[model samples]
Target: MKKFKVLSCAIATTLCLTMAPTAFAGTATKALSVNTDPSDWDRPNAGNFVASYSAGDNYIYTALEGIYWSPAQIDNYEKAYGRYLTLDLKEDGTTHSLNGYSATTTLPDPKFDFEDDQEDESSTTPGYGRNEEVEVVSRGALSDWTRYNYTANFRILNSSANPYLITYASQSIPPLYPGGDYNNVPGVNTTGPALQGEYFNNFKTSNVSSSNSTKAAKTVGILSNKVEVDTHSKSKKAKVSKAYDDITNRKQLEDYKKKHRDLLDKKTSKKDNRNQKVKEEFTVTFNTPVTAKKIKETISKHNLKASVIYARGINNLGERVTIATTELTDESLNKIINSKDYSFKGFIEIEGEGSVADLNNVQNDAEVYAVETADTESTEHDIRPMGLSWKLEELNK
Candidate 1:
């Protein structure tokens, strides 16, 4: 029940400011590389009482500087041509693009704040009327072992000719944090106990898309490729309707009714049993096309008890992502046996051995222990563990 927190420090300004912005062509001149400075961003911690040993980095703070064009150039172009320029991230791989992350471009003008209009009353000022730097902050989590390469492209609106997509700059993002095991050397990367297993199963990042990207063209004066995953499928009601429509006679109708009644009875029985074969419909969107056989193989490789009733890829217009639908039958045993909360009747299993107070990064020799989750949840708050009782000098070698 002992509790502790490891706060991830913000990236030091000294590291960010040192890199010079790369230059591009035309009005969209300046380009910045994806920031991968390893100063303490994206560090993992134990959420609530469950610990995580997973190692991955994120581009949450990765920012791209805007155009350096003068205000007159911007106003004259907009006034004369009646069009706006936009920015887009042209990625070379599926590493970050298919993850459903979005970016926000902040206007450099002081008259309007990024979130809301600075003026109380409305004005005729177009969002991108003034030429300014566009700061695009992208939200994406990079895999520990994957490398991402991409370029910043600007779309220039042309009244007479086809719109131009100019590549301003490009960058290669390397893996900053690869999870590993210690070799008994100081300053060497090592894996901890909590990192060895999956703590929680929140494997989806689709809901994290930015709302600002929707209003970019009108307000922020930029545009980005809309990242979306279509997860639609025919409902059970549609199946029933189709079956009813196919019945042409009284005998067929009676047969369908009896089958429906049997199905309802089976479902009722399954609902009442916790260990029954429960089917869950799930959709997994990958960056590339994958066969149903491949999906089934992956499920079997993971040792999941559920059978893949059906798995098929549904992609549209050859998008960068491939959406696949799957039906899984009862895999509750994995959750029931592995999860700390459900496994031990709500008690948390600490990763390391010894007392619950000995949880630390340097506990290379500590053993595993089971601590009551209620101890930390108590109102007294007196069960907190002291931080890092390990010897500090051992890390200096």
Candidate 2:
């Protein structure tokens, strides 16, 4: 099989921050707008394989920028103060409140795993949630995403604006690469053919070489496993034990057994009622080493509500990214199916498409894809007909 690679840049310095409010004639309505001049930065490719019939001047591409603050990090920071630091924007038309991060503020606390730290290390750190940065880009604004280009890097704060959630979306600008990032090379890794579709399914280690770049490096695949959900329902086990009549009271034990058996039967009945349903698990793996920024990008694209998880050798075969879907919406599922991420990453079924590849803005989604009990995986090395690498382009127009 043919192979190629797209590199996701973690650090870029050439892009400039552009935040302007859109203007409307004779009206006072709340909206956002912008104009920009990006600094020196190279563009990264999001695959554009589809053919556009329009010629020059037929379309104009506009770029939008989206920045993300960790929900866990920021919310926790605010929770410690008995108030949240970031605006909790509600799609239900509720106003949200967001407190900007302060660089010098002390962290409230950090979640601790006693088993991992053995209680010796102080889990809290200074500025744990104060890590705020911007992701900027200029590209063709196409909802169907026929034209676009992008540049990214870990950013320095603009310092002039308070962070805000996207309230408005920009419209069309001309596309950057009309033809998209078509696969330029042909030969793949030695293991390409041998480790086809089922590679991640079996948790096997494999290698594939890039058919495009100037350098040839071995690629590793990362995968997410099927989740094991153990439901805990209302139980009297703790209540009975708390009675405190005696440590070995037979009545307590008897009460527990009766309740436990009833629960078992209840669980069995529920499973039996929904006999045809399957639990879906979609896994996203990186073939290349993913940076903290790209991991956030992957989660946002899928809408799985993911957080970046890192631990050396945890997944057995680590490719730098491991985005596991703990929860998914039906709409997100359909999007996953049609998504470039779904196709490029390879999956038994799509959990969600990797839209940063082809999607301009999720202006309006007609279909979304998700899988149940089926697994999908991504790797840094996987090549597509239009070779591209992406993470944040999904947020902008």
Candidate 3:
């Protein structure tokens, strides 16, 4: 297991002076783009590792320009160690870690033809590369004009070693040695043996650092920048429950019909008509035994069009239970339940129509222990499925 030292350095003054602290406040902005091109920034030496950053209302975005390796190198590196980029974000003196990878299966090959012309080795550039972008949101609201610091690093496994190893930070090699502040030091072989068919046998040590040793691995660092987050504070609100009466009470079916007029008229009119003919069975149970005749009489008293289908034998608790079928609208059923004089318990299992409010009203008026819906196929009688289906059908139609 080999280890390297961590490096730290402030970004060049030229890059920092380009953007003012006040200019980034109260505004969403992106940092300068980073790439292999040397002429893009004042520090042309930082081309190996380029980065761009932006701050939005709630999140900070960071993009790392990918390093190019020959297909052979990628194949061998991926075989020895998995491909991944580690990001270290420093905000208000705290460090956060993030990871990203290539979004695509196959990466483009190196752009320059290194094999055809050995004489132009100095002018040759990476032929293949990748770019990774990640968005990070703070746990709490970010303060406006707050300075944020960040560093990015790329790594691979050193399969050439007997134990197999990976490096985090490069050893002292000058200028690019320390990498940057918050840099990771390469340590012992965390990952075990390499798999068969992996391209590790022909591994290239030059790909690991820029050191003078034959075992040196390639390491690059971007010009670190201080990003100022704009002032945008979110205020906490006191939660108050709105009274049910304060809400505009509209019939569930009417609301559905109004929202899907085009769909009902064009596509589902026939299906909707068929659904209207399907009646559903509802069971009303009492804590004490009540006669079927009494239940039927009660229905008639409330002006509800419901018929007692059957009455069941007394349960262990000696409570009377009756099942009834109804084609009455949900509003009508709610009205009947609200008008009941005696306390009862039960569920309204409607085949096609009903709302949560309707079921709630029934439970409140009848002291129901549970409510079930056949249309929803759920014991809790959720109306979301019906609403979702209606909306999707309307959209598709």
Candidate 4:
């Protein structure tokens, strides 16, 4: 094995390339969660792209600018592709529209239940964290407005696992902004010590972008509206399109989940592994006899989402009935695998039999498909557990 240096923060030229269209859906209503950390993002920022957030307008944008685009950091983003969108809810968890964001890290937990749910918001503090619930949000839904109880204070998220949260920006001189203008913020730290329960009134929202759109608007041609981030803070974003066409096209987010939910579960340490059991979401597709509605209802009884599109010509279809949980243990964990839903004669079992070679193989054909995935490019990131990510550098030349 070889160790690659963690990607340093710097803008690079992003070129449009053609690839094969995936035979799945786009990121719409689901999320792919994994137990990972900063060290993970720190691994390498390759195969990932940087995106910019456009609030109020309900869009997440990425610039066409890169190091290859302009010598200065300000004139980066040029192309505009509103790939993903957000949905608005009417209290019933029903999606009402489309939305987007700046970085993949900006995505909120999909199955958000309560306003006060405890997931760490990577950018700002008091984030929507993942718990034992399936956050059923649609693509481009409002990940904004997380419910907060703590008053008068902004929760500055470190995104680091081991944290020094109690101290204010004062305890440490103002850290370099992620992508904010570096010159004006000052060298000697100005933020101060404060009461434990008291909120920092002027808690700053530092937005960074190596995107030409942001940098250009602020520094050169366009309406520059960007916060200066330290030179140390670099980000990238990439646009992926399946170069080839097929009866089915590939997508990320929603589309990927439908087909790959099984892989999601397979990634789990199942059966006699003895490692701590964390709940994960998996999707299953039923053939011939099962109805998507009936399968969904059955899986829903277990808190899962089922869909028909992924199944296409198949019968009942579903992926995960439950998200992987960190709170589960031994025998209690086996219940899911042993449930009637996953019985040897059932659809999921059949799919398992198709994929796994030795014990799980019960069929020659596999159900479900995965496509349209995205990764956040970073050299070093202070990420929370299960942070959404993928690598575009892996695709970039």
Give TM-scores for every candidate, taking all chains together and pairing residue i with residue i.
Answer: 0.17, 0.16, 0.16, 0.22
Question: Candidate 4 lDDT, tens digit per residue, 70-151?
Answer: 2122112211121111111111111211111001111222211112222233433422331111112211122122211110
Measured with C-alpha atoms, the lDDT of residue 120 in candidate 3 is 20
Candidate with maximal TM-score: 4
Q: After superposition, how far is residue 275 of candidate 4 from its true place, in Å?
A: 5.4
Q: Stretches of candidate 2 above 4 Å error? A: 1-333, 338-397
lDDT of 2: 0.20
Worst 10 residues of 1 by lDDT: 108-117
The C-alpha lDDT values of all candidates are 0.21, 0.20, 0.22, 0.20
Model 1, span 9-28: residue lDDT tens: 22111101111233311122
Listed per model in order, the count of residue pairs whose N, CA or C atoms clash below 3 Å is 6, 37, 18, 94
Global Cα RMSD, each model:
27.7, 26.4, 29.2, 20.3
Candidate 1 pairs with clashing backbones: 53-195, 66-134, 352-367, 352-368, 353-367, 353-368
Task: Please tell me which model should have the higher lDDT, number 1 or number 4.
Answer: 1
**Candidate 4, residue 95: how far the Cα is off, in Å:** 21
